[model samples]
Target: MSDIISVGFIEAESDATKCFRQLQYQNCPRPGAEVEIIQLAFIILGLEWNVVDVEKEYGIPPDMGTQINSTHWTGMMGLLSEEKITMVLAIYKIFLDITPERMKSVLFAFPSRYFQTIYVVRKPNETVSQNFIMNAFPSTVWIILAATFMIIWLIHILHAIIFCPKDSSIKKVFYQESGKSLMQLISANLRQTSELNSTGSLFVLNFLYLLAMIVILTYYQTAMFSNLVAPSYYKIPFRNRNELSARLLEGKVFMTDIKRRRPYCAYQCGDLYKALEKNPMKVRNTDAEVFRDISNNGVFQSKLDVNFIPSQFNWFSKRYDKIIIKDNLEVTHYTAFAFAKSQRKLRKKFDQALLKLLPAVEQITTAHGYRTRRRPFNPIQERHFFALSIREHFFQVFLIYIIGISLAFIIFLVEIFVYSKTFKNIATFLRLKT
Candidate 1:
């Protein structure tokens, strides 16, 4: 009976002596099988392989029932896929004989790591391209606009300084002295005017100077009114802080306590009256009586006596007597937006967005009952109780001009009187000498 050979497996690097020992223990194959094992080792190591002439060359027995399998080859192929090995020599030797379809199948079965190497190999010129288009005209336009404004501003300043009454005060004084030098005149008059200090004269001079300023300012304001164009940007409707504070108190009627301090709040007297009436629970401090009197009287009555409460806890009410109490509240709307330099392509889109959003913003604000002014409060109507207040500035300027002309005439008369007296004295002395 033939002996059954059981193959023994060991680690790939096991020594030949170890293999022999294991084989001896197993009493595996006889001497002829040992020669076959040596031949199998040569075939597995790639030393030589010719299966067709195997019997002819070695005279080996046929069908020895020996089969050989190598796990090392399987592990090498797995490492190639995982490590993305793409050496040209390895490819030519291992994969050159493989069919194109079979090659593709093997490549597809690999993990993404193998494909990463394939992509780098195939597309050497691939890169990301970025496009940047910058529009610059809007900035240029703004620069031009700013320059134009500066030029116009310079011209207006020059005109105001050269022709405006306020700026010409010193020139007017110098011109009034006629041919006499100021120093000479002052020296001569020093003894005569000893009892009169320069302080009184200085005061009078300043008063006249301010009066001239008032006239010019009034004329400027009146001209703006008559033009109907209204210098919207330059015209500061309020004359001073007192008026501003008064209006702020008035806005307290509809505003929350916190809103009263806001820069844009109008604080009109009428609004203040209404606010006080609405919020009775709101504590009024020391100024409550004064606020009540102003609310009832529908007038600030006296600028000095005006009362102020903390905008948070206290508010001003609308005056019952004033038409604004029933009329549309006059408030100014100020709007601001960011603009890019000379960028016209996006200008329309940006403007459209603003127009769309502004209405919604206004709607939300209105829905919340936030009081916004339609236009600046008319000082004339409030102060004078008549449209005549609008023209008051014009009249005031005209009065100032009249006063100036009168003073000039009076000075002319004094010069004439002084000259006549000096000439008479000279003539009398000459006649006595002759």
Candidate 2:
């Protein structure tokens, strides 16, 4: 029998190796049958394959070399565990945990791909235009204006209370009573004036404050109540692992590290460390498990309602259609194949074959979904809507117009009902007299 290499793969599909399979696969004879490229790479190096799928491990205790354990082995800790697999061909394992014992046992290879932080946020139902702080500046500015108006309103109220007479009655006109004083002060705040008995500083302060309040309030109301239509752009709620961790802390999202729990940052990123510290429960999830196909139509797993991925994923992004992959790159690391340290000769042979084949092998065209995808970039399936222009503030304003018309019609009916009742009462009274 040919030397069969049992390669570990994170099944349920969300692992980084899904893209690795995309790199290896070519012809599929039927649906749901996958032919991986790593499998081909091993075959190219003259090795038979035993693809071992990593099973889900929820509510299980930590194994040796785990983050929870006393050993320094982090991430998956053991790719060659159970002695079933001769090598680990995909996934980046940082050399931080590679101790002298590990160095003697297993050989780590060079990284093939660059990885960065890409956030998978819940696909929002509305446009993201004016959603971020750029869009929220209006509210902040309005709050400032309201603060300024409040100061002015307070000044006017004081002028009405202290400078103005408390009693309006002729008998008590000279005496300052608290009741009428408070009433006048409150009334000035609403009517935009202060009826002070004096004319110098008190009048000036009251006039300036009341005038400023009225102007600002009028402007604020105009902005708030106008037929103004704002455009919305699409945005995911969370960005980085820390933000997702915040959501997890707040119970806005959930994380499942059921398959492989020991993800002590492959690159030991400080931000990821902080995020993990903030939310220990926001465990990492494999991409395949998180995103799975359910229908003939390429709909992702409906149960994937994660408000955030809640953890960092060491992956690349060349195309971003739905989940926004920002330009900010994190945890720079290389990817390479791994083998037992004893198999130096075999590893060298594998490397030699990779040198000749990778450039050509990687040039595979994008045709079928999931087969040719890489990292964060995947071809988005196209859907059609019959000529509805969504580029600007079109539908948003139209919705406002519809709502306004509906309110107007309702008021008109109410007015008609009241007028008809008045007329009916008058006619009945006249008829009774006659």
Candidate 3:
């Protein structure tokens, strides 16, 4: 009978509080990817195995080393280097970059699975209510509309000056006819009868202007209605590293596991790396702390926290509905098992076993909700579609309506002050009486 191989397993801190336990053999409701791979490896090798907690046993963390050359090995690497454990089970080779020191210290088995870094960011919620009308059309569309309005107004002014009955100065023409032209344009757009008495070219221009207004208003009204009914989709805050750095500058905390953080920012250069290094507190010590930060909208002093995590933990992003992921800045890596450099023969045999078991591991991973294709991140919440809350959905439209009413009231008061002959007559009568 083969001797029972003592294999050390690094327990994931995140799975500590999970109802579905990790690193379990019998009757485990949900054995994670690592445990699943270990179980398959043991079954294929036809060997009895004992699982040891490398982190709990040794004060060292699973994080091998941040700096390349180290006299001493720490964590699972230390245990493996000393041959305390036969081989560390599921020592993710991807977590730490494959440095020359690491390659020399440990034997990496055939890569078991592929993984990449994913940036999880909060969907931006802050939108300007005053921009509701402007946002109905894209910036380019609004610009075109404004340009068209100015052109039409200018043409009307030129036509009025050219066709005036009496000789008038440039200032007199603009003052006497500009107000009338603007009022006619406004009245025409509102489907009211335009008081524009024109004959030849001016008449044709007026007709074209009215037709253009019809088309413009048609599209504008359709867009406005759609905006009122449809769910509001905010642009993804940041997709690339540069944009992410800008967000970090805006007080958004960057979150990552304490163990894996060193490698992520190991480049020791670039704005992103520097930004990550600035926030030490963001490197969460415990899994519970990380989970809490992610779940609670990542609100650190009213700013959302951005998370940099492996694609494996993407389920956490899905779990917290508010969390959205951007894979544009993903760094792909092939992960493998780590063995002590002394155990070359064992490592070879383990590699052969793992090669055969990869297909099965993939199937198990998919079964455990780790799909090959990741779920797409959407800013629009699901509840927005099914449950139509007036306060949430109609707030912009309601605010716009209030603004229009307030503007009309202000205009009515302005008219009373500007052109109310009755008010002037009443004041004169009162003065005469006094």
Better of 1 and 3 by lDDT: 3
Candidate 3 per-residue lDDT over residues 1-434, each given as its tens digit: 22877777655534322322333354555545566687778789877776776666776665553433464576667777777888765432214344567777788888666654455444456342334456678999878877877888898788777776676687678777788888888877877788657888888988888888888778878876565556556555565556666666666655555444542432323877666566433556776776577554342211111112322222234454444343444444555677776779878888888888877765765556433334444555432344434676566678879998999999889979876898899999999999
Candidate 2 off by > 4 Å: 1-103, 114-203, 214-228, 231-237, 257-334, 339-368, 372-434
Candidate 1: lDDT over CA atoms? 0.30
Best by TM-score: 3
lDDT of 2: 0.45
Backbone-clash count (model 3): 0
Summarize candidate 2's per-residue lDDT along 316-432 as a digit string, tens digits. 233333443332333443345567545577777777766765554333312333333434322222333223344434565576689889998997898688689888998999999
lDDT of 3 at 188: 78
- lDDT order of candidates, best first? 3, 2, 1
TM-score of 2: 0.42
TM-score for every candidate vs. truth? 0.19, 0.42, 0.69
